[model samples]
Target: MKALQLSAPKQWEQIEIDEPSPPGPGEALVRIHRVGVCGTDLGGYLGKFPFFSYPRIPGHELGVEVVAVGEGVENVKVGDRCSVEPYINCQKCYSCERGLTNCCESHQTLGVMCDGGLTEKMILPARKLHPANNLSYEQSALVETLAIGCHAIDRAHVTEKDTVLVIGSGPIGLSAIEFARVAGARVIVADLSQTRLDFVTEKMGMTDTIQFDGSEADIEKLEAMTDGRRADVVVDATGNHHSMRRAMEMAAFGGRVVYVGITQQDLQFPHAPFLHRRELTILASRNALTGDFARIIQLIESGVIDTDPWITHHAKFEEVIESFPAWTDPESGVVKAVIHIS
Candidate 1:
């Protein structure tokens, strides 16, 4: 089987690897159909993702078909098309025991901490696969990316009455905006790129957007959008420390702030007075739960969340080495890039 591996930063090699063994108990052999390239993959390519290691098969967002399933694997069967939950958590961990499997004490995320489904076929725990028979391969592959935002919205408890501000217009940020809208919250998006801001407004039908540059004018615009009260919930998906810090200032009194983006850099916030005065709640959202995957799949199947305009770029498995670098460039205008493996 051929697999794409990141030998090192800025270096990609298509290598031939031995075929994976057949499914064991509680396992399923899946044929990879589509793979979604996300921020983690881009960061791993540039050696920027802290948890990523070199010589890895980098793909987590997957659409796959069940080729075979071991005994007792009733959740999926032969020929079932599914979206994979790539967060491999230890079920015995404290968080997992409490149903917070997204943040297991020791988590091994596919494509980051371990090899993922960027190849022809791979064996996964059957429980990690969520059957999405109604969705296309491209739509099924994007469910994981959407799940990140779905979980973040769940953490913040966003409601119809709340005004939500999503920072960053990247895939993760866009995912947050989608679920926030589904929750019936008034959505406001902020991004440094005018191009991206325009994308959310035009393509995503978001009317309230601000070209943010850490300026007071940006805050003024946000306040104006919220009738001078500021956003009731702020979801920071930029993963930039500056933007994460500014999220504190973007929220209204008694607001909740969810950090969906991860950064290795140490973050420092000096707004103790403001935090205490406003009684703010700070939350760190990690990966998505199985329920999130189920909900997002249903949303896509029901036409509540459109996947038509999300995929802005595409490449075959063989062209990944040549096409990946270009996708990393912001000028390429890639909202979501899917790698076709079959």
Candidate 2:
């Protein structure tokens, strides 16, 4: 089988490798159709993602078709099109036992911790596959990214009366905005890129936008938008540390803040006044649960969520290596790039 392997930092090579065998018990054989490229994959290419190692298959966001099934596989069968939950968890862990499989004590994420779906075919546990019969292959591939937004919104328990501020206009940030709107919250978006902010306002029906100038005036603008009160629910989808720190101060008193982005720096916050006085509820949202996947599929089917403009770039498997660098450049206007594998 042919696969794109990250041989080292800033290096990608398409190479032939041995094909995975038939699915074992409780697993299914799946043929890769679409692979969504995200920051993590780009981080791997730049050797910036934490704990990422080289020679990785470099894909987790997948839309696939089942080719065959092993014994005891029941969730899906041959010919079913599905989206994969690439986060593998140990069912015996305390977190998993509590139905918090996204943060299992021992989590192995595909494409990061192990081999992933950038290849032509692979065997995956049947339970990780979510049926997406009503979705196109590109939309199915987006389920994973969209699921992150669903999980974050689920964590915050957003309500109609709340004012939600999403501090990024990237794919993940856009996902947060989408679900926040579904939750009936008044949505506000902030980003350094005017192009992304315009897209959010024009494409997603978001009217409030904050073009971040890295000044206190930005917060003032947010306060003005909310009638002197900050956002009731703030989601930090920009993994940059400065933005993450700013998110803490952007929430209103007694508001909820969800950190959906990951940063490597040691983040510091004032304890006595800011966080402590506000009585804020801070949450760290990880990968999505199985229910999130099901809900996202339903949202897509019901036409509540649209991913049309979200996908701004596409490439064939053979073209990915050469085309990837341009996607990394902010000027390329890449929102979500999906590679067709078959």
Candidate 3:
């Protein structure tokens, strides 16, 4: 088996290894089919994503098939195409006992904390799977990414009547916009690039965009977009500390702000202005639950999720190590890159 491994930051190489053995007692051997390159993966590549370890296979957005099932694996079996949950939690933890395993005290994600599905085969715990009915490899790989947005929306509790402002036009931000739209919030997205804004407008029918770098009246611009009242909910998808700080300044009075982005530096914000005015600020980590994954699959299968515009590029597994680096460069317009393993 050949795996694309990130030995160090800015260094990804393809190394040949023997095919993994059969599944263990509670594990299943997934024949990895599709791997989605997300901002999370890009962050890991650039040495920015937290909780990442080197010499890792950084692909958790998986589209898989059960080539072999473990001894007691009854939920899925051979020939079953599936999407992985990626979240590994300590089932005995207090949070897990309360059915809120997203905050599991001993939780570790596949790509972030352990070997992930960047190779031809991966031995995964059977519990970390959601059945993929008829979805293609590329589409199946997207479920996990979309689920992140779903989980964020769940945390924000976005409603139909709210006016939403989303910062960043990256894949996660776009996914956030989609979920917000489905939740019935009128959304306006801000980004530094017009090309990316055009992508949202032309392909996704989102006409509202704020040019972040071009305008000095950015706060005023966002204020105008929300009819001078500012946004009811503000989400920062740009992991940059500056962008997140700016997002705090852009929220409406008594509005909610969800920080889906993460950075190493401690976040800075004005003290009295942030809290005294009654802003509900939240940090939305990677906490997509099984319910969100199920909902995303339903939305995609039901035609509610238009994934046609989401998938921008695809390459064979053999080309992964070569093409992965290019996807990190924004000028390449790699909105969503998929690696086909089979």
Cα lDDT tens digits, model 3, 1-342, are: 888888999898888878888888989988898999888788899998888999898889999998888888999878988999998999998889998877789988888888888888988888888888778877889998898788877788899988888898888898899899999989999999888999999989998898897345998888777778888788888888888877767777887888888878888777787655755565565668888887888899999998999999999988877887889888999899998878
Q: List the residue pairs that clash in candidate 3.
A: none
Expressed as tens digits, the lDDT of each residue in 50-144 for candidate 1 is: 89998899999999999999989999989999999999999998899999888899999999999999999999999999999999999999999
Largest lDDT belongs to which candidate? 1
Ranking under lDDT, best-scoring first?
1, 2, 3
- TM agreement with the true structure for every prediction: 0.99, 0.98, 0.96
Worst 10 residues of 3 by lDDT: 278-287
Model 1 lDDT, full chain set: 0.94
Residues 1-342, candidate 2, lDDT per residue (tens digit)?
899999888888888989889889999999999999998888888888886887888899999999999999889989999999999999998899999999989998999989898999999999999999889989999999999998999899999999999998888898898899999999999999999988888888788999998899999999999999999999999988888888879999999989998889878888767689999999999988989898999999999998898898999999998999888888899999999999
What is the lDDT for 146 in model 1?
Answer: 97
lDDT, candidate 2, equals 0.91
Q: Which ten residues in a row have the lowest lDDT in candidate 1?
A: 267-276
Q: By TM-score, how accurate is candidate 1? A: 0.99
Tell me each candidate's RMSD, in Å, in order: 0.8, 0.9, 1.5
